[model samples]
Target: YVAPNDSFSRGVKYRIDTDKMEIEQLWQYGKERGKEFYSPYICNVTYYNEGHYLTHSGGIAYDSEGNASTELGPFAKLEDPNTVLKSITVETVNDEVALELEVNSNFYRANKFTLYAKEEGMSDLELGQGQLLGTLGETNQMDTEIPAEETGEIVSDWHEAHLTEEVDMLTFQAKFEPGTLAMLVLEGEEETRQYFISTSKGLRGAMCTGTFLPEDDRDTRTVVTKDGLDGEYKVKLIVNDKKFETGLSIRA
Candidate 1:
């Protein structure tokens, strides 16, 4: 059996020969000097050439108490309002650091391509919008029926709410106190859709990507697609016991 030191994120470089089907290890950047290079989830080393490579040490995380944590940064952040997420992207040549950037969010991997490489797709992208392929995952819904307990008051200044509408979806943005129970209710003449908005931080069994992780853990953003619905709906939010209209309406 083989095991790492379990302290820092791990990085390794290998030499693979296609003709002979041979593989060789060039270096491993697990425990190096006084610095740390560890990314357990989605990161990679891009070989520019011999002795030059770009390493992405994404997924570095710490708990609310400022202790190093083994849990994935993005997932842990989702589960706890105070958990921190960070990514270290370094470009090293001959074991010498030419560039290093630290971001306050987790990433799948750093980009290996040069900026505007081949003017790739930029020309085409300007011409039209790309359509999302396949179906989106099911939107979480609250089945328990609760008629609007409309409170004439607006959500408190702390939430800092904003509702942005696109052609096919509405992105609801706000901040919530950790452990606070909340729900988003959309009432339209065609039909009504209700969703439970979770502000309570809790861990999940698995995580695919952390691209959508917000910089601030308290930031709550939910994308409610307008598909399969028609007409305009009054957007409202239920915090604790009372539901209040947002003074905004969106048409699907």
Candidate 2:
């Protein structure tokens, strides 16, 4: 019922509790003010004992036609602001190669993130020493639908509805390049045995899960793990396959 309105001759209604030292209000305008006026938006403020206050706020503003205009506050930041996958551990668990990782989106969108592995003793990473282990896909879009009547400017009826949507799992395959590491890298286009692992569910904030593999697996080289489908962000890569060989480590 309460709204922010600078159009009304009497000005918009506002509430301010003396003890609270803060005022919060919402305004609605009966008529749009020519493109000069900005659309409604949310704002925050912190009072400094003095009459003045330091305020920080942000939101999308629109013109008279309700078209998005300039954005306000910190929301204008350009960076996509990605999440961090922490506590990543890849080990042979039972018959399967288990990948356990933790990620914090910090309330941003993150798509399918994957893990990769490669043979050891390969000095050149670009020479193809890695393969996909698994994928963890995530989404933030809700499945809620908008009603026709409520969509129009004039309201008819109002009712709350639950969102019904599905999130897909991250997927990846395992294909160890078998040669002396040098041969596999030079060949480039060899059809290795690739294994497919299905993602079990969606992830938000963080995810911790493991996949199974055959016990006969012998991928012992300090394998290289990649993030996402493109295999970017090398997780772990060693210089040599044998313990006696010198160790060259690169982590992403």
Q: What digit string (tens of lDDT, one per residue) describes model 2 on residues 1-252?
A: 223233211113357878989887533221233222222233233332333232221222333344433332122222111211111122222323233222321111212223444456543346556665654432222133211111212211121111121122222222233332210110012211111112222222221111112222322211222222232111111111311111111222
lDDT of 1: 0.73
TM-score of 1: 0.55
Candidate 1 per-residue lDDT over residues 1-252, each given as its tens digit: 222224555457778999999999886653562224555576777778777778887777777776655566666776787877778888888878888888987777786665454665664435467887765545667879666567888777788899988776788988988877788888888777888777877554445365466766677888887666678888888887788778889886
Model 2 residue runs over 4 Å out of place are 1-42, 61-66, 69-248
Q: How many pairs of residues collide in each model?
A: 4, 11
Location of the lowest summed lDDT over 10 successive residues in candidate 2: 182-191
State model 2's lDDT. 0.24
lDDT of 1 at 192: 74
The candidate maximizing TM-score is 1
